[model samples]
Target: MSDNRRIAEEIIKAVGGKENISSIAHCATRLRIMVEDKENINQPAIEEIDKVKGAFYNSGQYQVILGTGTVNRIYEEVEKLGIEGMSKSDQSKEAAKNGNLLQRSIRSLGDVFVPIIPVLVATGLFMGLRGLVMQEQILALFGLTLADISDNFILFTQILTDTAFIFLPALVAWSAFRVFGGTPIIGLVLGLMLVSPSLPNAWGAAVGDVEPINFFGFIPVVGYQGSVLPAFIAGIIGAKLERQIRKRVPEALDLIVTPFLTLLVMSFLSLFIIGPLFKSVEEYILQGTLFVLGLPLGLGGLLIGFFHQIIVITGVHQIFNLLEIQLLDKFGNNPFNAIITAAIAAQGGAALAVGVKTKSKKLKALALPSSLSAFLGITEPAIFGVNLRYGKPFLMGLIGGAVGGFTASLLGLKATGMAITVIPGTLLYLNGQILPYLLVNMIAIGVAFTLTWLFGYSDKEKKM
Candidate 1:
């Protein structure tokens, strides 16, 4: 048998064979497979396979890191093994059926947020850049003050930094429609209409800066800028309404009638009913989450820091996107980002310890890359493939994360925005708090690394 075939066979066997896998896909560096039974998979044997970087179960998927081109080659080989292939859409649909309530919720949230993270990440980088340029220290290096920057340049930065949050409702709407089996373009248009310039902006209405237009003296409708729940709820409603309308409308009038009713009914309902109701609901949730973050003496930070990755494992961490967005919109900065970064840095630290201490060359190669990926802001590889695989290391990383979170809270460090972390996260702290951010990261990494190396793995396991 060819070497590639052997590797493919090992992957197939490790993941509980052909009957157990529902779907498989590959990204840049990992093979993502949804297995029918996670418990049936043999993890250690998979890790022992030559050229297999690492293996871990996360977010209801069995992800195997094989590194770049090597992953593609093995994926092709797996395809030839006569296992039925499936698309990501299939996996998503299957997600609802395969797991418990928490898993399904996390998977659904992940489905909605993962598509949007790229745009958010890009915008967050710019927010960081804008802060960097506005910092007094950095301004000294440029021999300028905030006033020294031209009006046009400042306007451009404002537009760049603000555009994403302002239109976030549209993105969420578009994504939610895709997830729920609706026509995506219509959802995009629906999102656009939600934030139409003619309506009062959501934030302005909340703070009493803009009054909502009376809809026949009964309803107060506003644009949903910087909002998540309203758009998400609206999207679900719109998608289901569109699908149902399409089924009942005559074939000839289907396009016109279906869209017309979908928009007229759903958009009005969203504006008059769902949007306002959910907005009130989100306000309460926002208050609750902020209450947690505001607990005295860093207690909030310690709890969140220690448990964020545990939430990540369950795929429910994306739920925090709502609270993070709320904080950013209202307060102009996010301390929550600072706390979460600590958790991520600790995961990286723990992963690095495994890489350095492992006697297996394959694990050594895998650990370092995964650790670097975590440091650069993606923690799946580190959290699943390394830290969590070694149970002690995972807990150690959480301890380090808790310490780092406490440190951040005590120092009152906060990020200029949300969604960026670790090295990319550094950009968010450029407003004179960069030193504190770096220090928190060092403490997280150092503590996690020391504890994980000392306690996470034994010499025998390292040799294995």
Candidate 2:
């Protein structure tokens, strides 16, 4: 039999055979199986299977870590064994049913933010590259200066770096509307209205360059460029309103009245109530984040880095999506990215140590690749497959993360983007920030690796 087929069969047996499985699905790195009864599965036997990095119970599924490309192959083989599977959409619904209110909310937030991340990442890269070429030192090296660049060229660069954030509300609202079961096109139009060209820009109004429009000589109004809460709130309210309207309107009128009423009512609500109220809320949140990150002696960064990975294990770290966007919108730099990169790097380092120190060839194979994945900015494999499996290694990783975070804050390190970290994260720091960025990651990896090698790992664990 082929290796994938054998592995698939072994996984089936370990999970208590086809009879115990209700459904199966594969993500980028995991084979998620919904089992009829968790008690019937042999967890140890699954861990011992060759090429199986690790396995864990999460939300309501038994997720087996089988690496990137391997997961699809193994999943296909598993299906060929007579057990049917579900689509990723079905899998999400099943998983959603299992989490608590908070977990589900966070997961929903993640789902909304995920689709917009690539655009933001691209904008960040554009900003980084622009900053790099425009630097005094770099330009001087090329016998050029900032004034030497054409005005049109600079305008083009600004367009690339600024367009995503300028329309971020539209993207967020569209995604939120879709997630909340509303008409996404209506959401898009509502978001656009928030930042309509006729209104005074939020930033300009803030700096007194443009005066806000007074609706009734008191209620101030301005474009919501770079605002998040207002768009998100508007999206949710609009979606719920549309759903309610759909239920009431006759079938013939539903098509016309539903969207018209939803947009008309939501537009007024967004500009008059949700926009102003949530703008303050967003500011307060930003202030709170700044206060924490501004704590003395890098303590804030230390705490965040130390706890970030732990939070990931619980599956609620998507809350950072809001904070990072707020930071980038306000300060144009994200210190949070620098700190979390350290936490992620430490996980890889610990896994790498495990891979090197273990005498068991089985473990060595899993550990090395899992660590590589973590360094590339995905940590589930490293955290679940290697470091977390060995108690001491995870502790060592936390310490490494804490120290790295401290150093990052001390140096005031930041990134141009979110979503990517560690190896791919370098692109976000290329605007004269590469040296300190590399320092933070290297220290994190060094500390975690040294600690794990010297004290965290033991060949004796092979016997266990």
Candidate 3:
């Protein structure tokens, strides 16, 4: 209809149009297309388009990397082409759909989760700073002791950190409603139902005794405070119901009557059907995950750790937060802590290797300091400067991380608590068996450093 819309139509046609596209998703900078056949898509034609940055086929998807602020508009255009059925074209989609109700219920949980990360990071850092201040000897110099500052800071950060989660249903409800193009108020009401104080607790005794509450002597709704998927489900239902009611209502009374009926009906449906069902599924997923993690810890650790960095790159690492939170709730700790630890170490290790191997003084200088930053768990410098530049270092780092993860898993090392600072965070895992994990950390670094050095260096450098 317009230039942007025309461009989207043209791009869709270039990618073999509606028939060829099996599914499509867009990240901040890339359009990921799953096509029925790669041969059907016209690559050069799409790339030749003014806004299209680049195109590549990898990991069984056709990726069109775009400039900033272009992805959403492109995605909307693709949706207008009636491509919603594309995701179901994949064979795995059915299995993914059937595996668990909660799995199907929270369709785009990652999408809902990712936008909140900056908030999480900010609050975590604030909390960490508060802890650091309390440990400072200068507290007394300011006429304050550890006790004076600790309570206030702790409460402040806890409120900030927990607000999103405590009212998780409301957040998910709002996000889901927005996604479905419904009223935020409708979504908010649905979310409140899930996390309402009157709702029954379904996480059982291990979760500190929750009593099942009955509404009207029939409908059973569970407490969903700090829970993710159930509220999302409720929100979707509420939005859909709202859409339907809006269409049926008379123009004169549509505003008030539509919302009133939508909220009332949706709330009842969520309580009777969606809330309890998703809560059960969430609990099952938690148990299944823990069971998997308990198996040959080394192999589990290796797979999980090796993919941690790669997962972060794709912006889906937040999906793992559900796992981490479940673990913390159940066992007071998590095994995948080492996965993140090793991923950060691998970046550092690779950067160090690059610093030593590269001939360019500028490159070396950048690599060395970037490597140090990686040790602090800041990965952008290492990812862009070292990994993307050298390439080999990234692969080496993956291998080393897998090795380290395996070792930590074998020793049954687990994080006692979460830490934002990588170096000091390692101490979170401290116990009688800390040495084994430390050794594993060292070995991973060693392997990455040695491999990168041997493979990354040029012949001239060796001869010199």
Q: Local distance difference test, per candidate?
A: 0.84, 0.90, 0.67
lDDT string for model 1 (1-464, tens) is: 99989999988998889999888977656888988898899988888887776777765678888766788899899999987666566576765776688777667766777788777767767877888788778788978887788899989998988898899889988988998889888888888888999899878887899898889897878888888888888898899999999998899999789988988998888888988899889889889988888889999989999999998876567788777777776677889998999999999999899899888776777789888888987787787666766688899999999999888888888787778799988878877788999999999889999999998876576454
Rank the candidate models, highest lDDT first.
2, 1, 3
- Across 1-464, the per-residue lDDT of candidate 2 in tens digits comes to 99999999999999999999999998778999999899999999998887788899878889999888999999999999998999764666678888899998888787778788889989888878888888899999989988899999999998998898999899999988987889899999999999999999988998999999999888899999999999998998899999999999999998899989999999999999999999999999999999989999999989988999999999899889899999998888899999999999999999999998888877888899999999999898899888888888999999999999999999999888788899999998988999999999999999999999999999886433
Q: What is candidate 3's lDDT per residue for 380-400, written digit by digit as tens?
A: 557654575456778888887
Question: Candidate 1: lDDT over CA atoms?
Answer: 0.84
Q: Could you tell me every candidate's TM-score relative to the true structure? A: 0.90, 0.94, 0.63
- Candidate 3, residue 217: CA error in Å? 5.4
TM-score of candidate 1 on Cα atoms, chains taken together: 0.90
Name every residue pair that clashes in candidate 1: none
Model 1 CA lDDT for position 320: 81
Name the 10 consecutive residues with the lowest summed lDDT in model 3.
87-96
